[model samples]
Target: MTLVLKAMALTCLVLLLLQNAPGVGAQMYPDFKLQQPQSSVVVIKGDTLTLNCTLSGSGPVGAVKWVKGSGSDNQTVYEQKGSFPRVMRAVSAPSNDFTIRISNVSLEDAGTYYCVKFRKGIVDDVVFRKGGGTEVSVHARPSVPVVSGPSHRAVPGQSVPFTCSAKEFSPRDIKVKWLKNSTLVRAEPPHITPELSNSSYRMSSTVQVKLSEDDVRSELTCKVQHRTLAAPLRKTYALHQALRVPPSVSVVAAPSGAVEVNKTVNFTCRVQGFYPGAVTVSWLENGTVMNAGSSTQPTETSRGLFELNDTVTVQAGEEKSGSRFTCLVVHEDQEPISGTGILRVTAPALGENNEGLIGDSSDILLSSPGLWLGLLLDKALLAVILFFLFKRILP
Candidate 1:
């Protein structure tokens, strides 16, 4: 009887060991598994995130539930065949792939999550098994960078200070770089300031560089880098000179020499080497301003500097001899500068003979006989007027 009992006990022990064998349970029904056992996901704010938990061999599964938290304090974030949250949804059936999607993820959605498969036993018992899990981290990207300074203008060998700033980012892993004309600027030491706010970070970087004449036309750019961005963000500034200069003014008369009566001449006024091109050129005849023959546009000589030309036409007359012409240049916030020229007119002369000499000249020839006769007549009239004046004075 004792041998029979021992045989039965041994048989029972062998059956129990076979049931608890390592390969036996897997051969019959594999343990519940996930395609990716563990994962980590990082996303930016206002962006969508998807976590897929593909189930392998979870048999007799009732439903799939996504829980947020670790160990015992876990809370169901989403469950298949249940009321879904506005931002959370089950993308596929738990039996296939227990995938969940979170739309418009924000900082509040950052946490560890797990996919659990629920199975009901033959009685009133319930069993839970881990399918997969992931750690989700949601971050806010920094604001668009801003570049500012005390002045946009600087002189050669002067120190120019500039500040570049970004706000409201996460993870504290942002990089800032300064560039001049698309090339990296590393000579100047950068001053960086970072502040923490509600677990997020804000940053500001500053640089002071001594500028030379060669950097006058260079473009300075601030580049920012963060994990949330696919490419670095950039801001650019063009430098200027604060010291101002006035234009040089000069005038030239076309068709030089003494002009005859009823002849037109052009006086061109050139203004050069001026910055901030706000200048006006005016023609002056006998100290009076004339508004004729003006240019509509000024030419750019260099950056922020310009050159201009203005002309005036004048008709020569008998009374206009020895008349003075001036070109007055008016600049903004500066004293006016001017250049001057003179006009000379001469009348034709007459022959030495007392006989009346008459001739017509459609085109005035200065050496013609008619001009000499005209000049002699002018001299005789003057003598007669003077004699009358003297006779009246004697009486």
Candidate 2:
């Protein structure tokens, strides 16, 4: 019975040794030292940042975890105690560098950040870190204002009204100024573009000035300043207007006939429809200005609407062919208007067996049988008369 008890004790010992063997054969874990992180504070609602953690000597880290410690239960930031919330990446070289990325940071995110590595249920290393902080200063985009003032280009003392405004982004106290050649112009009651964006933004500006062609031609600018934006804003436009003028020239053909060869015809051109109308009028034969043919007598229109003077009458023979006549008009602005009309000379007809005479001009008609019979009767009568004359003249 004692021998049986010894065998049972030996078996128990063997079982205990087998359980301890795996744990004892494990390699010794090398210790890691975490270098302290650089300290920094950031402004709120502003730039984003990343925290970098460095350490000395790398160990066989089963898992690297990130965590944030609070009073009660340590809140897990990137890793739970035994497992990694993320896979830890390491450089193949001997040095250790771990960087965490943070985006669009706010003030509340400020606190202690840590990076810890673990191996075989042993704590390898711990690193303390902090991301930059921010001071909350919220602002919005500024307003767009209207441009106004005297409607045209300003002269020396014309007091051209120049105006701009920002009605939208209000209560932000917008300031406006005028700029010329990139330099600010001093004037009473400056201007600016206000926050056109909703109340979320700040905006303001204004510009009122008296200017001229020189001022308008020079680069004109409206400057806006706001508390929120980093720099001033501006807008610009050219001052110009399109003006209208009166009517142009008039052309007419006289005697209104198709002039055949050797026929005489006439032409006339006068300045007609217009306002504060034409000051001078003349006709052009082809390109030659007909200044010699001026009529001093002015004829009033039957409608009596305007005074029509300077009738240019030209006597043209049929030899004048393919002649172009134009009436020229010069107005108050010395603005000139010209219009053209073509002259045509008729040509005579052409035919065979033709005579210079226009009547019965064909030889075929003169050679007809009826015409020959009439000619023979006349010849017979003339021959009888000649015989009678011989009879009388022989005695």
Candidate 3:
């Protein structure tokens, strides 16, 4: 009976202790959440970044810290109560609101960031919770792609070379392409270069093409794609009818036969073998320029080249003999080219069937000084002989 009574006493005490024991439940830490959902944030190298974090739940906030990177590389960049040289903290209106401002971001700042909260636990030493992470991306925009070479103007059956380049872009992945009349073209591999500091990369590419006559109306373009660009950057160049061969000048004199003195003569300068036909013809007499008469418009030849003619008329005279006449051709394709001819002015000679015929002496004597003297001496001798004959007949 005593044993039974002891057992009932022990059961009563055990029941009382069980009623006073605390209930088992999951451990709780301070409620932490990111005001802005974790997302990609792109900014220039010199721009500022702002990250906001919010706290909830009923508990005294032990501490707040911002961590950067992942795995073993994780590093605490900013602490609420700790001093960070680069982070600028703004005064929070509400005590639960935390804002972190970072100025002068660089390549090293590009990574994921997290806002972590630490709280002291009742039984456990300490507990922590992390808000959503913000992915930070710092970038440098590349300079506008430059397209050069291939000649602004080119001729058919020629090999044209071109280059496209972009400098100082962050993140080495960049797309460069070539197009002719909006059609894709196969080009050589791009040449990528890292900056001396190794923080930025530059890219360049080249292409060579054999042009055809049909390509004269086509347009070529270089297109570039990058992360910082909203649209692809493009540079366009064209190849049209252009000069291929140098200009050639030739001088011709009218009346292919013997030259006459004090008569009208025509000098023609013909320029040929040049394309894009912007040319000027000049006539030079004894190294001095003279006014020209007529110039024909440039006309295309069978070879797709240009040819033009200019004429100047002058009266042949004695002084013109042995004088140098030059036909100068000035063209866009090359320096001025010239052709020269010497003027040969001669007096008319006596005809085989001379029936007192002067044989165009009127035009001849005007320029020949020696011929005038000879004619005067002949007339004086004839008068003297006629006087002698008349005196003899009278005797």
Q: Which candidate wins on lDDT?
A: 3
Candidate 1: C-alpha lDDT: 0.72
- Candidate 1, 255-349: lDDT as tens digits: 68887777787888888866556787778899987776666577875564678888888888989888888988887656789988888876654
Error of 2 at 147 (Å): 7.9
Off by over 4 Å in 1: 1-36, 52-63, 70-76, 81-91, 94-96, 116-133, 139-168, 186-218, 238-246, 252-267, 274-278, 283-293, 301-305, 313-395
Give the per-residue lDDT digits (tens) of candidate 3, residues 192-272.
899887488899989886676555456778998888788998887664533145567888888654587887777788887
* lDDT of every model, 2 decimals: 0.72, 0.52, 0.74
Alpha-carbon deviation at 255 in model 2, angstroms: 26
Best-to-worst order by lDDT is 3, 1, 2
Instruction: Encode model 2's per-residue lDDT on 1-395: one tens digit a residue.
Output: 99999999999888645533444312332344565355553323334445556655545445445555544564555542354423333433234665554555443455565565544332333222222312223333355555554543233335445666554442356577777667787756543333343233333334455544334235556777766457876776444221112343566666575655655545555555333323666778889887655544434344222345455555555656778877776765555777776777777767633665456535655756787788799999999999999999897
Model 3 clash tally?
A: 0
Q: Estimate each model's TM-score.
A: 0.56, 0.30, 0.56
**Poorly placed runs, candidate 3 (over 4 Å):** 1-52, 70-92, 95-106, 118-128, 131-133, 150-158, 180-185, 209-219, 238-245, 248-260, 272-314, 317-395
